[model samples]
Target: MNKLNHDQLLSLEHPFVKIPVEKFRSSLRTSQKHIEKEIGNLTDKISEISKKSVQGSMEPSQVEAALEAIVNRLSTLKRKLKDIRADEVLYSQRTKVRLQHLQDFATIQTLDSDEYARWSRVRLNRIVIDYMLRDGFRGPAALLAKSEHIEDFVDIELFAQSAKVEEALERQSCAECLQWCKENNSNLKKIKSTLEFSLREQEFIELARERRSQEAIAYAKKHLTPWQETHMKEISHVMGLLAFPPETKCHPYKRLYDKSRWNDLIAQFRSNNFALQFFTPEPLLNVTLQAGLSSLKTPMCYQPEHRNANCPVCDPETLGALAMDLPLSHHFNSSIVCRISGQIMNEDNLPMALPNGYVYSYNALTEMASLNDGKVTCPRTGAVFNLTDVKKVFIS
Candidate 1:
């Protein structure tokens, strides 16, 4: 495979290349925010300690305690910085691997090479595992990741963290998710996210649902009042829940108390978490498949008579269904892909039509003939033909 110079590779706009580049850039931004926050906290602590000393209130024990606090804070900062460095290394390695995959495609003479096949298999596994992990199929995802030996390449552990929050939400508890929001409070606030406020509002609504009016009021005063500037209207509606019971059919109040709110919260948290981590909220598998199937889609793919047996867009059960709404790929001329070998038919790999009127690539037919006593077998119709009887097909 030929190596791609950096500029040329970046100009191609391939999704495989684009995704990693975006991820690397987002991860850097997240890391920088964390580092800056930590450093600011450390500076604040040191300044507080100095202010006390200058005021002559720094007793020996107090000084000792302050020093210990600073030490612990510094240790935490150091550990976080180390983790950031490790993440940078891992992300850099993966970025290079993906870019190399792009470079490999540049000079590849044939798609049937072992190296190309391996890369393709790895990509499929990664996509499947990613989808599984996001959709709460961790058991199967883990098994697949283990089998493929790509534990490092996939974000299993990261998704596992999200699963915990999602599970908590399913059980109608917001404690775990609230803690996560707290942990990422700074990042979330930077985006002007309403997630934490929404969670708090839900908690207030739950208190109201239980008919604990006093407790609900107290919860609102404590947790909901702080968002007055940004969410005053929302907070007012939630507070109205205190008057009406859960069974009330009031417009906004009833809607707020709907059971689906929990599901919405789960989705909200997942989106915010993915954003924080610089990952797409949608599964990579879905994104990749949609992109691929769209490119291969054509109007003829939907017609039963014109559909090829091996066409992805013709398989009604899976790929076809995905491509149903996708726009067809723009084509100046149609391309024929062999049903047997799954390769495009061109002059080099000429299309050969058997007596049965089914077409396949010459390379596929010749190979099949060599293996089957000088005869070619129709994969679609099960018709057998002598290799000498096949005719080459030409396209204008």
Candidate 2:
């Protein structure tokens, strides 16, 4: 012990400590800035592209291709940015926790007792989820969703304007069985009633208006005559949207976890508030799952369609036990095959269902781009490291 001086030890330790903190902070700032800048830049490009297209300088195909390219880039960038942001917050949370532990150590140093070691060992992080902590907390989400890519968030079929629907109605070649309300001799006496359902200001619903449109279409088909099918495919198509209800509201993973479990833990942390700054054990209930479901950003116009006085999902007690964060009522049991002949997308990104029968959930696609992220691997190098690996290194 006498061989090395205290100055020598401090020199080595100081750099090892300072370097990690500096590196993580710098990386966090830089990563956030990079994503923010790219989002801004792409937004400007999309605006410019829209202006050029309106000026008739770009072909429809060219405009579409350009938009698709932006979608691809935005997806990649968003996925990367979200991951980076999550990592950034996580890093900060860890550092803050560690710093708290260190502070406790310093405070207990002059007490002539070893309670600091015991206190640090108690581990306080159990009270919160990683995303809820001060360092990683999310602010208001609506303010955050102002990105230009936000429109891509809404997925619907027949997203065309009302003007387009009117044009479709005017085309006599459109539907063999359908007649304009003004020209329907068979229903001349029902003119006023028929006119109420006319397409002058109507909207068309095509493709996947939402995930389970197949159900809505089947429901509509039950009421459609053959002539109705030919004349009102667009109208019948929108009926498919009734299969699933919209998402009306969503909460953060942390809020759900805390809402469900905080009452139980509050009593437990009574006398050891300071001692909790240390190791937070992995939650027994999967926090990530809780967070994922709880943190869902609800879509617009989601009115729960309950036929009775009761909520369809079941009683609050059962739901609470099951996990309040998850919308258990939602089902992904339906499958659809694309009607047109073309390549289809598979979950694993493999070529499947040629000639377009492969089904996709528009909601799933939008959420895939915006809401959450699966782990990433470098396509070329295949480099991957679990967060636990980083945690272990930090702890040691």
Off by over 4 Å in 2: 1-20, 109-112, 116-396
> How many angstroms is residue 249 displaced in model 2 relative to the true structure, after the best TM-score fit?
79
Q: Relative to the unseen true structure, what is the C-alpha lDDT of residue 329 in candidate 2, on a scale of 0 to 100?
A: 39
Residue pairs clashing, model 2: 124-276, 157-209, 158-206, 216-239, 216-240, 217-240, 253-291, 337-357, 338-357
Residue 311 CA displacement from its true place in model 2, Å = 79
Name every residue pair that clashes in candidate 1.
Answer: none
Best by lDDT: 1
Q: Estimate each model's TM-score.
A: 0.64, 0.26
Q: Write the per-residue lDDT of candidate 1 for residues 1-396, one digit (tens) a residue.
A: 533244542343344444556656766886788778877987887888889988987886897898898788778877877877777777677778776665665554445677656766877797788788888899999999898887655777777888989999999999999999888888899877899898999899899999899898888889988899988999889988878989998899989999999999998998898877767766777666777898889888988888766679998888998788889998888778888888999989999889988889999999999999999888787888999999998777
Give the true-structure RMSD of model 1: 7.4
Tens digit of lDDT per residue, candidate 2, span 1-396? 113232422332232134235536756776777778778979898998989988999999998898888888878877877877775665565456545544554455332346643652332222222213222232222223223222111111111222232344344222321243333343334322333222211211221234445543553454333337344754543343343233312232222222222222222221121112121233312443344344331321133432112222233344233444465334345223222222233343222221222222333333333433432222224443222221110111
